[model samples]
Every structure is written in structure tokens, then in C-alpha cells.
Target: MPLFVAQYPIGINSHVEAIILQLEIGSDDVCMLGMYGPGGVGKTTIAKAIYNKILDHFEGSSFLENVRDKSGTFDGIIQLQEILLRETLGMNGQLKVCSESKGAIAKENILRHKKILLILDDVDKLYQIERLIGGFDWLASGSRIIITTRNKHFLQTLRICHSTYEVKELDDHEALELFSMHAFHKNKPEEDYSNLTDQVICYAKGLPLALSIIGSNLHGRSEIEWKSALDKYKMIPDKDIQKVLQVSYQGLDETEQDIFLDLACFFKGIYKDYVVDILNSCNLYPVIGIKNLIDKCLINVDQFNKLWMHDLLQQMGREIVQQESPKIPGLRSRLWCYKDAFEVLTENKGSDNIRGITIISPKLAKLQLKAKCFEKMGNLKFLLVGNVDTCGDLEYLPNGLRVLDWSRFPSSSLPSNFRPHNLLVLDKPQSPVILDKIFEFRRKLEVPQNTKYEDNILMDSHSHRKLSHQIDYSSKIDFSHSLIKPLSTLHAFMMDSIMDYEESYNIIVTGKKIPKWFNHQSIESSISFWIGPKFPTIAVCFVFHLVPLKDSYANNDKYGSIHNDEICWNCHVNIFTNDHTQPLTLQRDFYSMKCDHLWFYSNSHSKFQRFFRNMMQGDRNLVEISCKISWWSSRNKKFAPVIARMGVHAECICHPPNSVIIDDNSDYFENVDDSSDDN
Candidate 1:
């Protein structure tokens, strides 16, 4: 038995011991154990540790490293079987089994009589296992065979293992300790380098292989060199780590490879089903391709069904795309680097090879491109532009586009000749171009503190033209009309101001009415309703009317900044029914610079049905439903949230016997004059 050479196995002890317990190697029965996880998760290292620990207890032991790679060599499986036979039988020279019959003869005659421990490292295919180990029946009782693979499906399909263990990434403490050992030659960092050490650990993200490679590369380097290395890693991954991760990607087929690249470039952290739908429209078998990726430990789907990949693996995939025409941004299959994507568009350097492009810039800059920039990108399928003001005629758009999520689009309208016949999703949020007339007064509003404008000034009535110059209702009407025509071809759509925690836009709308599609409507903050029996469907709506700041306050520099007095109103709705002791609570945050309403509806009945059952408990008689709404302002100590008019609406299959009414104790809308002072 030969000892394995692992310098620092910080997190492998627990995994090895747990897998050993799972295998129950002490039992008299023959056992086959499998260790599986994503690439570079330390599966082989743990297997090697286990093999070396129990080698002396067995009659003989053999560890076959890199079975997936070695099998591709000349007569690989045959040579592997011969090596296994010679090691277990205590032979001195290499045993040559050129043919299948010869290999089987050696396996059955000499190797079957002894109790042996065999470890197969990095097995990817089922045929490799079949040819290498055949069966446990041929080995003596109490014998054990361990297999380490990236794909769990291979083990299930072969049925060669009685137990399987998934090797997880190292925890924070273990990752830091492991990284410190290689970087600083100790288990803990010195005081001066503590923060730098933490940054390195965060970049590694608890992946042992990444930690090892980076730590070793940065060992004994100065502070300046460490900082430079970390900065470089953001754009380009360490080559040593990328080489290991890229092997799994290389094993994928053509369509699967495309799916992987697309996810790496654009769809990471997106909902898996949503990405699958978009990819399916592009003729990619995302359903099977995603499964394969998961099996290979290249990607993971969390409990929320959102797809996530390790940062290193994602970087590796992007690096692969980056290497294809490294100097020429136009020649790559995917363009995600902001500099590259911007250059490709502004310079008309895009080519037919470009499949996807994402431009996300934090700075406020207008990207002016020639109208024919996308003319050559006929193969483009996915396009996402965020926080970028794109201008130009844009006379032509590719007909094969599947997703066009351009936030803050600069054009007044899409070109007439541009056709998106195959488009599946169109998300143009905070679209200033579509609502040019409504947003024109965003910077010029000078309303007094106590003035009350007529509802028709902003409402959907013909009288809207009376205030056309101050606020154009015609543009709003045109915007709404133009938006409705594209709903037939889209799978999902959203149109609203984009507000994050740090900043908000100045755009505001004065409308206060809910959409007509909502069957029930209310203007008060809280409402109580009775649901009759057999009401199958229910939908909820929330409408908030924003009050603009006074001209005096807006002009003052100290108070003018939106951040100084900006308040984020968080609304919580509590639903009470007669059946349950506790009320069901739903919460949403409203951060629009202007007035906005949120509608909650389900295209599928299952989600609504589940919600209805949980809230109503299938009661046959009339059930009282009460919703209480409250709001709190964020970051404003003196500013209180006042509801000019808040509403909750419920839609169902049939109307209740009694009409919805406000709770007598609730003072949501009563004494409107005093309510403003209370906030």
C-alpha cells in the first residue's frame, strides 16, 4: 500500500469519515461507495485519503486516478483491469490483458479470491465502471470499492454503488484556514495581512481547489502584488483553477455547450424554468442540458429553483468565451464585458458569430451607435442592456431575438422595420422613451403645498388635454395603446420606474385608478370582505398615490436631495379568517418616485388554489376576510407616510353575497385633513 500525498486536507477528514460510515465497510458484505460533487470540490482528495487509511486492513488495494482521462488512452480500460489484477494478486510486473476474455479470466481466477480495496477516481461514464470493476460479486466478502465522479446520474444508471455521498464545499472557517496555510505558511494570518487574507478567501468562495491554487500562486508576495493579483482575478481567473473546471465544460455536447455559455454570460442567478423556456425557443434542449450540467456539478439549482454556479466556474466559462478572439470583441460568441460590448456596438464591430450581449454600466453615459450596428448580428438571440442610454435610429433589429430587456431605452420608439416575431420576453422598465410626454415635466413640477388638482387632469378621460402642456395625457394614452399591441407575442412584460436602495428617479404619474381588469376595488388602506362558498379564484391589488414635495423644499439644497428625506414605504397586509388562529401576512415594499400600483395575478390556477386553501380552509359558509395595511418611512425621522388614497381589491370567480366595507375601528381614510398631520 502506498500513502497518498495531500499537503493540506483541511476539510477532507469529515467527508471521508462520513462516507466511510455510509459505506459501513466493517460489515461482512461486499460494498460499493460513490463520492460525487462538482468539479474541484475535493472528491478525489477525499477518496485518496480514505484509500490510504484503510489500505493495510485489506488483502490488497489499488487506486486508479483520473479514470475519465486515462480511459481515453490506448487500450485504457484493458490496461486498467490488468493493473487492478496485478495489485490485488501481489504480482511483481505489469499484467497485460489485451482482450476482454483475458481481462475477465484474470478478474475471475486470481482477483476474486482476495479481500481488496479499490478506488476509481474521476469516473464520468458508465462504460468506464462496467469495464473496470464489472461487479462486486467477483470480489471476496468484506471487500470495498470506492468511485469518485462528477456526475451522480452515472452512478444511478450503473447501479454500481450501494451508497453515495455528495462532497460539499468547505465552510468559511475551514476555507480561511486552508487558504492561510498555503498563502502565509501557517493556519492563521498575521495581523497586518488579515483583511487581505479575507478578501482572498471571499474570492475563493470556499472551493478548495481555487483556494489552493490562488494561495499557492500568491504565496510570499508583497502587499502590492497581492492587490494587483486580486484585481486581475476579477476580469481573468487563475489559469490553474480554470484548467480543472474547464474539463467538465469540454465534455458537453454542442447544444449543451451553448447553453452553458449563455448561462455563463447572461442567465446566472435567473429562474431555471424561465431560462429553460427562453432557451427552448432558441432550439436548445435546455431541459436535458440543464440536467446534465447539474449532474456534472457545473451548476446548481437552489431551493427556490434559481440556478447558481460557483463564481470560479462562472468566471471560467466567461474566460473560455473571452479567449475566442481575445483581441477582437466582434469575433467572440458572447460579449459580457462592458468595454467589449460597448466597443462592439459603438464601432459597428459586431459579427454573425455574436450570440448574446449584456451591457450593464453604473455610470450615466449615452451609448450612441450607428443604426446598422446590429445588422451583422443575425445570430444574436439574447440581448440585455441595463443602466445604459442607447441612442440612434436603430433602423434594423435582428428577427431572431428572443429576449430584449433594455432598461431606460433612449429611443422614442422601436424602428418601424424592426420586427421581433420570435421574441419571447420584452422587459423595458423605466422606459423614458415610451412615456416621453408624461416624463417631460419630471424636472419642472412646481405644485403648491395645499392645491388640489382635478382627477381628470391625470385620469384616462378626454378632459386630460386641458392640461396638455403641463402634463400630457395624450402621450400616456399613446404609450398605453402602443404597449398593448406587444402583449400577444410576449411571455412576460413589466413597465415601471426602476428604483434601488441608493437612488430613485424624479418621474411621477398622477393617476389613482386601478386597472379595469380588477373586479373589486377599494380606496381606503384597509378593507373587510365576506367570501361566499365555492369562490375559486382570488386576486389582490395595491394602489399608492405619491405626493410631490413643495417647491420651497425642492429648491433648498439640504432638503432638495431625494436621499435626504426619501422614505421607503413598506406595506404589510394581514389576512384574517375564522378558521385559523393566526393571520396570514404578505408584505411588499413601494419605492416609486411617483404613483404606482401592483397587481398580483397568476396565469396558472395551482398557485392561487394553494393560497386559497391555506387562507380559507375550504369553508362552505361565508367567511370574513380582513386586510390591515400599514406603512413606515425609511431614513426619514420626521417624515411620515400619508396615504392620499390607498386601495385593496379582490377578484374571484363569483361575487360575495355582501359588499366589501371598511373596518369601523380603522382610520385609514376618515378625517383626511387630520390624517396628513398624524403621519
Candidate 2:
């Protein structure tokens, strides 16, 4: 048999010793060992290592690769027989698969008396292996057979397998060494890449194939390139590794495949029983499908009975969904990412192809929901949202929904026409829609420290959104849980300000145009608005296009894409009464954005019970806002390498007394040039 090549063979000696011990070469009884693991965990590599290490001990040996790839038909099985016989017995190339127990005892007896070692690699279906090579009775005493499969159950049930070797993922140290060998041409990462190396290892999660492919993909790349590649891999996994892992997934039936994808997209880490219940409601036959997934090593149930999947496999599933409709998320069967879900609902782009959606903790301060958003999502069976601020109550819902777990539902009751006949889980945690107390503050509002203002202003879908909970009111959302996110919120400054202000405006950039709601508009770099008793409190909002920073290092093809937690654009909103006075600047902070997006420094809660009454008393003082955007790292942001790329002027709007209105529509937006671009 031609020897198999084991790439980056780390930790193979122990495996070879274990397999050889299981074989028991000196024993009188012949043995067949089953080797199993998920794809890319190095099952084939270990088998090859075992084969090369012990081939000298046996008189005849054969190592057959990719039995799964060639087992599609009886002809393929016959081909596998030919290779096995030719390698083990020096027989002619022609061989036939036995239709019954040992086809032609004369042919089978050729190896029955010879002490041989044989390996069948990548066997998906056990029946194929059984038909190609019968039980150990056909082999001589002291002979050994080792068969490898992705499905552990295949080995567990096969009585002929005297022992089974469950090949586990590489340990951290070995994984790092193997990865660095490909990534840095050394046994360890370069001096300054310890953290980056750790991140790669963590994401790869000990899968040898992922390590090798990702390492090679990032080879000779700069730190920035590594970061970019890592970010992209999360969104779209390594194509080669994905291909290797998808073989097992493709072996599943249609319903099993759906269950696997569902778990990958939304159910990972959820209790196994809970997942089975939800999937059962969808008529997916979850009991059997989940079992199939477990048997195939697609998912695992931990001690708590929660489902866990390999990170690469989960990413691969999501990428499969994304590939269905690369440019339009609405056309895909599932939606989990906040950006994709937000875009589909806000743009009214939902389609019947979408089967489920889970939108959690949207990056926007307030997410305004309209009733018509789900009009086209007739096939949507699962919907879950948490920490989402919506304008008002939902007016409609489909009857086919099997799961509806929405936090912060804005209505006092479910839609009048909506029915719960098909509902399985109606989860509403800390919801205030049942008996909410809607209170109106005095036109003058003062926010005390350690107190939360209502979020109505942020959720209002009308013309006058309230400052604090302008309309949607339950709890105040805080960014305190995150390290870098605090630098992006107005609440960071609201609690400690020396002077009491009625309102605070947080900045966000999206692929949305500026709404035509502000009374005063400007086309220049700055805007002036008059605030009076009729409209004392105000919030600044605008949109700016992202133009490239000239001669900046972060202008490569993948530079615009980055981890939101690590990088951001520092924007300054300077407020001035006139040119002679120093501006009362909105404290400098960072917000994540994309190049095609517009900037909107919008949403605030609470009425300023106190304002610059002295400054506002005469001549209807015009509050001038000058906004500029620059790129910066979340780390050492104060000393950021600034690139002045955008200058946007925002129009200020006053909140009314009773009801709040916020129009998140695409209208009356005048595009301002991103002056930072070389163009």
C-alpha cells in the first residue's frame, strides 16, 4: 500500500501507540477497530499515522482512502474491494462486492489465512463497509482492521469493532504549535503576535483543519490584515474548511439538515428539551433529527443538556444561509444577525422565504417597528426579539408562528386580529405592555443621577418624539456592561454634568438616509436652530456619508470592515452660540459605521428642567452645531491618529408636550460631500 501523508503531524505518536495496543498484534484473535470523530478533527490523519507506524508488523496491509466518496454505488464498492485485495493479497486488480456473506469463499479465503492490516477511511454509511469487507471471520488470526467514520454511532453499533478510538480535537498547546507552523513558519507565534495567536486559537476551538487553513490564509499578513481576515472568517468561514465539514451535514436528511441549521443559527446553548419542543412544534420530527445530529457529531449535549456545536460548523451553517441570498437578507431562510434583521424589517424587505428571525440588542438607540414590516414574511414560523424599542403596538401577526418570544412589546395587548392558536412559547420578560403608567413630565425636565428616563423619545414613530421614554417606557438601556461601548453613549456624560440639561443626543451611523422631520435644515458644515418655551428641549440628528481618509493606512479593501468592539470613528459635535465663544462640545466619543452609511446623531430621553435660561433669554439664541468625523482605535482613543473625513451639519428638533413622533423614513435628505475623501 502506498503510504498516506499526514500533514503537520502533531501528537501522532501517542495515537499510534494507542491504536497499536488496541490491535494487539501478538494476539491469536483478529480485531477490527472503529475510529470516529467529526470532520477536520484529524480522524484520517491519525488513521494514516497509525497505518504508517505499524505497517512493518503485518505481512500484508492496505489503506483505502475516501470510502465515503467512492461508496455512492455498487460499482464504487467493487472498486474499494479491488484496492483492498490488490494491496493485501497481491491479487489482480479486478474484484467484485459480495452480494452475500463472503462472495465466493474461494476469493475470500485468499486473505483468510494471511495476517494482514487494513484501513477504510471516511466511511459515512456502515452498510457499504460491511458489503465491501465482511466480518473478521474472513481474515486470518492476528489480522487487524481499522475503519474511520464521522458518525460515532456507526462504530458504536458495529459488534465487529473490538475497540473504538474517538479521536478528539487537538489540545491548546498542540493546536497553537500546529497553527504557528503554518502561520509563521515556526513552532510558536512571532514575538508581538501572542494575543492575535490566542484569538485565532480561541475561534478555531482546537479543530486541526480550521487551524491549518486559517493559518495558511493569514500567513505573511500584517496585524491589520490578520484582524481583517479573522473578522471576515466569522461572517464567512474559510471556504476550504467549510467544504470539509459540510460533508457530514450533507449526509443528513432534509428535516435533519433544517434542525442542524436552526440549532446553529438560534438554538445553540439552549436546553436540549426546549429545542426539541420548539422544533417539534414546527413538525420537524426533532426527536429523531436531533439524535441524528448528535450521532453525526454535528451537535453535542452538555451536562446541563444544552446543545453545543463547533464554532466553525455554526459559522458554516450561517454562511450557507447567507449564500442563499448574498445581497438581500430578506431572501434567506433565516435571520439572526442584528444588522440583517434590522435592515429587513426597517426597509420592509421581508419575504416568504424567511423561516425565522432573532433580533437581539440592536445597536440603534431606538428601533422603530411598523405593522407592515411582517406583511410579506408569511412563512416566518419563529420570531424572537429582546431589548428592542419599538414605536407602538404591533397591528398584525401571522397565525402560523410557532414561537414568539419578544421582550419589550410596546402595546398594552396583543393585536386584536392576531391569534395564539399555534403559539408554543409566548415569552415576555419584564414587559410593561399590560398595565403601564404613562406619565407626562413638565415642559421643563431635570434628570437626576442614578435615575432612568423613559425611552419614548427614542421609540416614537411620529413627529414629536419625547426626550426620555417619549413613548416606549419600560426600562433604561445601559452600555455599562461593555468595555468600549460606554464611550459611545450620552449617558456617560449626563450623570456627571455640572449643569442640568433637558436632553442628550447619542450618535449612530446606518445605511439609512436622514429623515425630513427637523423644522430647520442646513446644507453647510453647521446648522443654527432656535429653541423657545414652545419647544425648549432638543435633540441633534443628521446623516453623513463615509469618505475614505486620504493617505491613511486603513484604506485597504478590507479596512472598512472591523470588529466594532475594537475600532470606531471619533466624532465631535461642537455647540457654539457664536464664533467668538468657545463651543460647548458634546463630549468626544466613538461610533461604529460603514462607508456607504449615513450618520445620525439622534435619540435622547428626558426634558431639561433647567437650560441656559440666561443664554436663551434674548434674540432667540441660535444653537450652532459643527460636526466632524475621524477614525480612531478604541484603545488609546485620546491619542488616535485622526483622519478628518466627514463634516455634517445636523438640524435640531423640539419635543412636544403630550405625544412623541419619530419618522425613520427616507425623505428630504440632502447629501453632503465627505470632504475627507481625495475625490
Candidate 3:
């Protein structure tokens, strides 16, 4: 038995027992077992322990170490084959199996009769197994083959493993013990050093290899030295540990590696599906690449489908980019450090190699850059600047940008010649840019007519309805020339609403009245109207006029008698039958310093229509639509916005229920007058 198996102090007993049970090692049946996890998670250590415990029972055994690394060399597979053959057959000299065919012959003729225990350590590829033992039939009964790898997909592809176990990081107790064993050369830390020891363990984050390496490196150091080391680890990880963890990253192909680096640099903690869409638009083959990364333990997706990477791995990725240009931020492939990005922008030190940059600093001083700072960064794809006050013309932006999430962009409008056709996300929440420029940009943008929404409509239950006859109010309102055009970018706002219905449609503009196209209008916050039976289309529009205040007043006070830019309004719309049975409700948040109008439409086949039909089943003849508005100060939550004016418009396309004569030019609901009810 290996001495380390007995001497290894932390967690492994449960893992060993579980693997033994999963493999059914006690039974006399041929089985294959796999131990898989991220690099430095002790996959190899556990496999060795299992191998040592059961070596006495097998007639022949061979442990192939570093198979992933050695297999990359010339004839590496044949060399591994020879080791397996020599050990299992008890041969003194090398075998004659130079080629794959000879190796198959050797396995069939000699090793078939022997009961063997073979452990392939750090195996990464399928060909390594196929070129070595070939199959379980090549060995005698009761034989067990164990493989250790960083990727579980490798075992899945081979289909040889009867069972696979994922090796997890140590718990807090075990991690402290293991770390103390090396740091203090004891099982527990001294009473005076307990706090510092806990800090180290927390930084290690339960990774056994990191705890071991860090403990060993900091052994016999003073308290001051320990603090300095921990601080240093935050900025630059230990080179020894980084090298071990980077092997899995290096195993990825070029495109997979790019996805990994991007996640590490920019997208960590973001929703996984959203990241996939962005990367897929970049032509990165994200679906397969992300799967491989997860299999290799390079990244993880939580239950909420958010991407997460270990802190050590994230640091290692940033370090790799840092090495590209030790002093020059412009030469690096990605930049996330606040100081580095600030310097790159202010000094106009951008290069074509810079693919992505993110600057988020709440404490950094204001910065101003020239218009041509990004002119040379032709390959830039992702750019995000947050919290920092950046002032520049932004005359030159990379044409191939996929995401531009610059909050507080100083320019009034993007350059006329600048192209945004490749953009997947343009998130400028508090930007002062004019909406007309955005409308023009959207007009120039190429949108695929056959989008997934259209496909969904075709496949829906209302496929029999003629979608062509559905009225599209957006087409009739010349967005470029409309009065409301200055208040909102119609295309981008609509696209955002279509993408995520829960999120608010925010825009900054100045207006006081609803558009004239709406047939029905009211000045109250809440409006109720009666809907007849034959109405095919129903549209509701709400207009809000914002009152601006000084920055200090908005920031200092939480709740006052008036509303300002700091207030966030919660808007709700509900529809019910005449009997007060609710059929539909819509809620959204409204924020910004400009006047804006929110519009909602329901056609013959829309969800509202379906719900209305179901709710008004049998002989229900009347429907009531109600709109309500309330606001609270986002900063204090106690203050409410004072409504300058709130307007609602309800338009019905078809005739009233009992009206016999239908005039194309006459209003459908003009004769049915009802008092405005405010809630």
C-alpha cells in the first residue's frame, strides 16, 4: 500500500469508500471506474489510494502516470502499451508491440488470461485507452480498469467506465487541517495564529492543491510575512499553482480557449444563456465550447444558470493576459484592471490586439480621452465602462463591437459613419445620447425578417388566424419623423422588450402629451373603459412627464413631496370582465430623466385575446380595462413621484357590440361615454 494513502490527512476516506462501492470492487465482475474533477482537486491522489488498497487481490497491475502529458510525444501511446504489457505479463524486457496492430495482438494472446488492476492516471483522450488495453475482453475476469482525468466527457465518450465519481474540494474542517499540516507542520494552528490561518483557508476556497501549495510556501514565515503573501496572492497567484491549473486550459482548442478566456475576463457571474448568445454571435461555437469547459472543470453553471469560475482560475487567466505586455495595457488581449483601462484610454495607448476591456471603478478620478483613442483597436469586440466619468467625442469606435455597455457615455450621439450592425447588446442606461440617432442606426441595421418570434407565432395554437391582417401600429408611425421620436429610440426599446419582458423599456426625452395617433386619451393615472364583443385589436398607451432636479437634491434626500430623476415608478395595467374577474395584468418599472410613453397592443391571436376569450366564456358581453400608476423614490423608497400628467389611450379596431352601422371614419367608442375612475 502507498504510504501517502495512509498519511494523507484531509478528506478521502468517504471518496475511497464511495468509489469502491460504485466499482463493486469486492465482486468478481470486470468493471471500469473513473475519478474525475478539475485540475488540482486530488483526482490522481484518490485513484492512487484506490489502486494501492486493491493491488494485493489482482494477479497483475500497472499504474500509468502522467498519461495525458506523455501521450503528446511521438509513440507515446505505444510506449504506454509496452508498460501495461510488461507489468501485467511480468516481462523483464520490452515487448515487440511497436504499432497499434501489434499491440492488439499482444493484448489478445498474452494478457487475456491475467486478472489485472490497471490505473491510467491523468488520462485526457479516448485514443489513449483504445491504443492500450483495447477492451475488457482482452483481460481475464475480475479485472478492474481505473482512469483519472480532468474531463468527465472523455470517459463518457469511451463508454468503458461502469461508474464515474466527481472528486470535490475539501470541507472547511478538512481544509483547515490539511492547510495547517503544511503551514505549521502540525495538525492544528497555534491559538495566536488562528485568525490568519482562517484567512488563508478562506482564500484557498477548499481547493486541496491550493491549500497545500500555499501552506507549504508560507511555512516558517512571520505574521507580517504571511499578511504580505496573502495580499500578493490577491494580485498575482503563485506561479507553481497556476502552472498546475493551466494544464486543463491548455488542453482546449483555439476557439474553446477563447471562450474560456472571455468568461474569465468579462462574463463571470453573468447569466450563462445570455453569455452564450453573445459568444455565439461572435462565431465562437459557444455551445460545444462551453460544454467542454464545464466537463474540464474550467467553468461551472450554477442552478440559476449563471457562470462561475474559481478565483484561482480567474486570476490565472488575467495573469496570462498580463504577461502579453507586462507594462503596456494596450498590448494585452483583455483588460479588466481599473487602472490599466484608465491609463490605456487616457494615454491613447490602444492596440489592435486588445479584444475586450472593462473598467468599473467607483473611486477612480474622472478621465478624459481623445476621440481617436479607439481608432487603432480595430479588433475590439467588447467594451464596458461603468461608474467612471469619461468625457470624449468617441468619434471612432470599433466597427466589429459585439457589446458596448458604457454607462454615462459623454457624447450626444454616436458618429454618423459608425456601424453597429454586429452589436448584440448596447446597454447605455443613463446615456444622454439623442434618440433620433439611434432610430437612424436601427433603420440601417439589418434585421432578419424570419425571426424566432415569427416562427413561434406560426407554430402557436392560433396558426389558423391570418397574421398578415394583424395591425402593426409601429409601421404606421414614421419613427424617424414622429413627435415622440426624440423621447425614445423605438427600435432598440421594442427589441429589448421582446428579449426580456420583465425588464423595463427606459428612454430619456422631454414631452408632456400622448401621441395624437391614439384614438382614446385620458389625463388621469388610472382609466377604465368598456370593451364590446367584436373588438379585434386593443391598444393602451401611457405617457409620463418627468420633472428634473439638481444632482445634490436627488442624491441627498430619499423622499420628498415631488418626483425627480432619483425616483423609480412602478407601472401596472390590469384588465377584467364586467363582473370584476381579472383576465390580464402587466407590470413594469419606469426610470430616467426624460418623458416617455409605454404602449401595449393585443391582436386577435395575442395572449390577452386568448385570456379574454377564456375569461368571458359562455355569455359575458362586457370587458373593463384599467391602468394604474404609482412611484417611489429609488434611493429612499419612502418618497413618491408627483405626477405632472398621466394619459391613457384605449383604441378598439372593430365595431361596438350592439351598434348596427359601422363607419370607417367614426370613433368606435365615442358614443359610449364613461366617467374617469382614479384608483
Give the per-residue lDDT digits (tens) of candidate 3, residues 1-679: 2425434547887888888888776777888887888888888788878887888888888888899877776587778878888877777776766686887788777657878889999998887776677766676788888899999888888755478889988999999999989898898997878999989888888888899999989889999999999999988889889999999988889999899889888887665666776788778999899999999988998774667888888888888888999988899999888889888888889999999998877464577889888998999998887667887687888888877777667776667677766665665644544433432222322212221110000111121122212212222222232221221111112111212221212232222222333444544444444455533344445544222222333221111113332344545667676565555776544433222233333322344455666555343245555555533333333223333233323344333333222233554334321111110
lDDT of 1 by residue, 1-679 (tens): 6656468979888887887787677788888887899888898889888987778888888888889987886577777887888888778986778787678777776547878898999998877876776665677888888989988888888664478889999999999999999998899987888898899888888999999888899899998998999999988888788888899999999999999988888887666766886788888889999999999889999774667788888899889998999899899999888899999999999999999888877566789979888999999998888767777777777888877767656555556666655665555544423222221111222111222211221322121222122221122222122212211111122122222211112222222333333334444444445554433344344534333332223211211123344334445555555455665455433332222223232122343344456555344433334433344332333222333333333433344434333332444333322222222
The backbone clash count of each candidate, in order, is 0, 24, 0
TM-score per model over all chains: 0.72, 0.63, 0.71
**Model 3 segments more than 4 A misplaced:** 1-7, 90-103, 362-364, 439-679
Runs of candidate 1 with Cα error greater than 4 angstroms are 432-679
Please give, for residues 311-372, the per-residue lDDT of candidate 2 as tens digits.
Answer: 88898888889899999999999999889998998888999999999887635346788876
The lDDT for every candidate, in the order shown, is 0.64, 0.62, 0.64
- Candidate 1 vs candidate 2: the TM-score winner is 1
Q: Is candidate 2 or candidate 3 better by TM-score?
A: 3
What shift in Å separates residue 21 of candidate 2 from its native position after superposition? Answer: 2.5
Instruction: Give residue 253's lDDT in candidate 1 (0 to 100).
Output: 99
